[model samples]
Target: MTTSTAAPPPPPAARAATPPEPPSAGRRRQRKGSMRRREAITGLLFVSPWILGFLVFTLGAMVYSLVISFSRYQLATDTARPAGLANYEALITDPKIAIALGNTLYYAVLAVPLEIALALGLALLLNSVRRGAGFFRTVFYLPKMTPTVATASVFLLLLNGSTGAINRGLAAIGIDGPDWLLDPAWVKPSIVLMTVWGVAGTMVIFLAALQNVPKELHEAASIDGAGAWRRFWHVTLPLISPAVLFNVLVLTIAAFQIFDQAFLLFHRTTGTGSSDASLFYAIYLFEQAFRQFNFGFAAAMAWLLFVIILVISIIQMRVGNRFVYYEGGDR
Candidate 1:
């Protein structure tokens, strides 16, 4: 009784509690691999439409054109016959090809610079606006919304050598405006005017680039006794050089393929000597393909244009990369 019941037998020898087992490495690796595969499948699904369209429409057409370039399509038989390099040979021997190429080159040189300058100037003005900026931007962009055919029609009336408003204004100033559409000397310039009218797209791109520039940099530039011109030239220009490069490359390619304005202005009058001034490469290619039914020659011309554009684009990108300044010092 004094001993009380036997003290409970000493607890079983203490055993350390074991930690829960972690997931096996193999299982972990399998889960991560599955997740990545799911993500990749999702990404591919998102881009599938674009991939399909490019394959069917763009790549397919390019391949077909390449094939047809080496063959003559006989209208009577409605078939293509292999002609080897004859079509390509015609490109070099044809005088009209040189003329068309010269005209296209001239237009590209003239239009690219004008478009860049005008677009940049417009962007600068827009960037300075604090009030009614949206309204002004809309007004400026309206021309781009206009259809090419409608714009061409309006230009015809404006470019009429005799009764045009431009000529009347020149008359008021006691200066004689040249026959814009008819005169060989002024025809290209007239087309350039039309091209510049639709430069709002480029201006908008510049505006977006300008807005992205750090305001602190500009403030610092101003504090350094840099005037507006100096700030723009030294600070703003370098900051926005990448955008300039983009616009330049785009405008150059577009200028090379210019067709609508030239065709609208000169197609009807092509037999007339004055229309010769507007005989661009694109228009000539159209003539060969549709009017003359020389599909093989036209295909060759298309390939030649493609080559020219490819070469020029490569050259521009390389040169532009050297000059373009990005925020991180990488182009």
Candidate 2:
């Protein structure tokens, strides 16, 4: 007993310490090198089509067009002579170009704001209707679903100067309906009016956004003694601002690229000699590229349009932070 109690066995020395157990298969992991490689391959494979299409069809063409813009280009002509930014110079100085730009700006300013307001109003109205909502939504959305070509014929007939329904109605009311498609002053306005019909999709978008807003916010505002107008002004508007901005961006681009309406309307109502009045941007671009055989100049115009769009988008994105409200916005 005394010998046993003399001392505990000496503690293991550092040299005699046991080694740590190796991890089991579950606990152990591969080096991650192969896993990373596999993930990268998968990502590339997933995006391969986009990359391939962009490279082959889009990228090269875009770059080549930009290059050609500095020169004079025609599909039939093999030689491209550099004009040293003369195309840009002409864009700024040319009177026809100036008129086109004015018309383009006018259309965009009128159409974008009008369309957005109409869409928002429609959304608000539709959102308030609980019964027969599906039917109303379908009715509202039918315009957008109709193909532009299909709508064009009806529009042409309605917009006809003498025999059209619009003129007949106006005449019945003792107001003469002006020649919408024929008169240069009225042609652009007719385009605006007709195109507003297809704005149903934007209304639907705003409606969806409005519906997604939580009822609690409205209730809380009411509890806080906010009037209906006050709640809408503070809560509803800010929340749906992102959607409005979206509509504005899309509608503006579409307005700028308005070709079909202008072209069809022009071909039907006014055969092309020169129309500085009905000079929407896309129609002007088409006329320049094909009719005038100034593809390079048209490409330059296209690039300019792209820049305008980019700048506008950047402006919208910058401005949205002020008015747009997200659920977790304050933090």
Candidate 3:
């Protein structure tokens, strides 16, 4: 009875009362929050330059151009006056635009497949070589590193109709070489040849893709009595389809934007060639923007080209997804 009476139970409120958090614990939490804020500020500071550059140079310019496309822009006066869709109307009415677009399409059709084929062939050859492989690879890739102007100059000499090495070689073989640069039929082919010379880059891509193909698949195909042709057609081609599609898409885009080679070859301080065969879309856009000072028209042309590229890219990607094989599975 004395022990029971020694202490009464504390009140429920007192029993439930909890001790306050330590002052050090509160300070530590505040320090953690401050450290997080500092880290966020540091990250923003580090990326600020890139953000500013992109906004000013890329996005700002794009927005300005878009606005100019809907106006009559005079570069001489640096003025842009609203003109509605008049600039875009020219795209439909101008025959030169059609001709330029047709030429670009033709070049893309010819160059893309040829580049892919040649690149694949070279990649296959390089992949098969065991000795002097690195040397051969370097030798083949050197053309891609050559300056475009220098390459165009050398090709200008090599493609001379009357006395160039190419025609001379053709004569030696008892065949006549076409006037590559002068002839309308051959101008694009000449460009294609020049483009193929730089196929070393695409070839390297294909070579990497080919090398990445699991050797075990090939060995298994061989064990299954698959012939060389069968193994290549079934096993090798599927594995490399993604690379093939990628190269084709890239080459197609480059082909559409062909300006330098055509300009250097067919256009000069004098004038464009007799035929309009070499007047690519990019060349037309340049002429509109710089030569004619029709910035509005040039902007329209740029937007049109952008739309075409975007649509074509979308189509290619959609089509490619069906055929391209990912290791894990299609995404």
Candidate 4:
């Protein structure tokens, strides 16, 4: 009684359950490999400029400096002659080298810690801001934007012993301020103050690090009866200690190479300012290279500084690794 058409001949065997035979394994791999090669070529092209610049400028200059450090450069003939170990020996025998190194060391010791603390404090305050944070950050960062020459000119006036704003302020507060620029004891401190004035860069770095910290850690600590101080000490400080280490290492290196502010503040064109107190290693190196035309000695000094910085950086990384907490494990 069924007038069926036999179900339309069973739908033609359902098309054999095979997916168009996927191009073969070798062909697929070849296509993928071609794509990767193209990607790699594009990446190399994008980064080629930086690589070229590093090779030509930084590495080339370093190599040139290292070569000249062993020879006496004749400015008249624009040539260099072998000088044996005279330049390296002078590094040890020169009295000015010691004085310059001592001054630089003192500045580093004073500036690095102060800058870290102040930068961290500013970062904390900025991070806590719920309103107009951008404006506050911009205002705080203005000092870092300021040109070194202009900053020096302004501080030269502000630090004047007789009628400077700083002394005036001190006097108003019933305190006597020292001769900031003139006195040997205060000269380094004055430079440190100028160095601190441009600490907004470091503060911004700290602010970035602080913002990345997990808020849940603070909340958990708080729930566990941790006061603000305790929470900050136990929860916040450890999380932020990597940033602290970074800032410390960078500031220390920069402190060693301090030149612009010291030169502008102390070694002006008029030949005024305290050369003795502000005679940093860089300043001395500059004088040797350009002023006295002792290029070999200056080059030697540069190499010595490079070695010193390298050693210190190694020591810092080793020591810092122990204290710096890595949320994802040790880097």
Runs off by more than 4 Å, candidate 3: 1-49
Q: Is candidate 2 or candidate 3 better by lDDT?
A: 3
Q: Write the per-residue lDDT of candidate 3 for residues 1-331, one digit (tens) a residue.
A: 3555557777676466688999999999999999999999999999999999999999998898899999999899988899999999989999999999999999999999889999999999999999999999999999999988898889988999998899999999999998887788888899888888898999999999999999999999999999999998999999999898898789888988998888887776555453488889999999999999999999999999989988998999898889888778864
Determine which window of 10 residues in candidate 2 has minimal summed lDDT. 24-33
TM-score of each: 0.90, 0.85, 0.86, 0.91
Question: Which segments of model 1 are wrong by more than 4 Å?
Answer: 1-21, 24-32, 268-273
lDDT of 4 by residue, 210-253 (tens): 99989998888889999989988888889988999999899999
The digit string of per-residue lDDT tens for model 2 on 1-331 reads 3555566888877686776767763344554666888999999999999999999899988898899899998767767899879898879987877787788889888888999989899999999999999999899999888888778878889999989999999999899999887788888888888889898988989999999888999999999999999999998988887787788878878877888877776754556423777877787788888888888899899888889888877897788667776678761
Decreasing TM-score order of the candidates: 4, 1, 3, 2
Candidate lDDT scores, in order, read 0.92, 0.84, 0.91, 0.92
Task: Point to the candidate with the largest TM-score.
Answer: 4
Error of 4 at 74 (Å): 2.5
For candidate 1, lDDT tens digit of each residue in 45-128? 999999999999999988988988999975556799999999999999999999999999999999999999999999999999
- Segments of candidate 2 deviating more than 4 angstroms: 1-22, 25-28, 31-40, 268-274
Flag clash pairs in model 2.
none
Question: lDDT (0-100) at residue 22 of candidate 3?
Answer: 98
